[model samples]
Target: MSTAASEPEETTVKQADQTETPLESLASICTVLAIGLFVMTFIFQNYKIPSGSMEKTLLIGDHVLVDRTSFAPPTKWAPFVHYRDIHRGDVIVFYKPNPETPDLFLVKRAIGIPGDRIHLVNGIVYLNGVAQNEPQAGKPVEDGNPQHAFDAYRDDFPSVPPPPYEIQPLGITASWALDLPNHIQNGDLVVPPGMVFAMGDNRTESEDGRYWGFVPRQNIVGRPLFVYWSFETSADQMSKTSLGDRLSFIGHILVHFFDETRWRRTFHIIR
Candidate 1:
């Protein structure tokens, strides 16, 4: 009986059966990276809260999905996108002006829009010379401090005097002091075009526009669409970036992911 002849592997069959050529491997990686970059650069991006600056609205460890296109300008290369202007009371995510903390993105309320006049007294905000109808600002907090219950700059806007509380921080609040006369008209801080005056929901604890300066139109990344996940982590733990601390945090997440998750906060919209 003649044995069946051994089949010789064809060159085409070998090429097709190869896991992938070097170029193809690179192509696959590039495709994945490109998609990720595109999503991060244009459509959506993630942000995490490391502090209680935004408090009840956005607590520490609240992971948010920010819609980058929400404020994206019309582009010639892309489709005709009708992006709306930023609105007052909208919660926005932006890069903190402090260059030292480049990765520190802060979440705050868009209290004053372009060309709007803003005034705050004892943490009570006034918009366009009228008391703002702010449900978020009025949001009750659990702060127990009675004295200095509001904030330091309660009486020092429009004509931001040398900060009475201490050496004025070299921030927007300081700039306002230098450009005091120009920025003030009728005793209200007039938000210049392409700049917004931002504040935190937990006004007393936040170091926002009242401490620093305006959030430049470009620094406004996007408004958070919703809280995708919220883990019960403290500000101290969230702020620690050491290797040991990070590993510990990761271990904690792995062990208590389900137990620590703020299930009620998931999908909670950011105003």
Candidate 2:
């Protein structure tokens, strides 16, 4: 037994400390915040429906998650991301193409794309000389119903020019009223290059492209992916911007969060 030759066995394995320093923790938090900010600003957006224009599909008080990248212009940096031309029948969110109200954002279905010929007959949309079968489009009330009145300006579109502002100031922007005639050719409204003809699912209720004008390709924000949440909110609630009203509504939401929430509409995908 050569005890002198047997040297003390060396212990090479040691436990490493895993606790994070304050600076490391701060860096992690900053990284997360940066990613979130990028996502919210350029990849996805949150929008709350303020009107019933896209009703049945998107109701007032329905908060939706919009995909901002799908319709965005393609870039050299993000080759893996999907980017496609806006197709007819796609539900789109865009800015109102009105000189007076340039910042108003609206959601409507794409009825016509560039170079497409569009017209309407009896509230039915005809695109590119072919009538589209859209089950999502709403119909007017039956004859004798109070809401059964028809407006040739809306249902017929371009055939009867937008009414005089003095007669009806709510629908049809001033600029559109002036420029509409230039686009009407052979009884069809020809969508110019880089323009989209958009309409609401509720044809009678939606003050869409027919009222304002074509949604410029550059003005499109994105398409709603799904309804993240929905509440029983009135259309006028958006106009109640007073501080007292805001606080009252916040209290009302706290008390009625469970009951007033439209649970069935939660996470409902927008078509």
On lDDT, the leading prediction is 2
Candidate 1 has an lDDT of: 0.76
Over 89-182, each residue of candidate 2 has an lDDT whose tens digit, in order, gives 8999888887677898788999899999999988888887888898878766567754445767888877898778778855677788888899
Q: In candidate 1, what are the lDDT values of residues 18-82, reduced to their tens digit?
A: 76889999999999999999988788998888888787788899999998886878777767655
Candidate 1 ranges with C-alpha deviation above 4 Å: 1-30, 99-103, 138-148, 155-160, 164-177
lDDT of 2: 0.86
Q: Per-prediction TM-score, please?
A: 0.80, 0.90
Q: Which stretches of candidate 2 lie over 4 Å from their true place?
A: 1-16, 143-148
The number of the candidate with the highest TM-score is 2
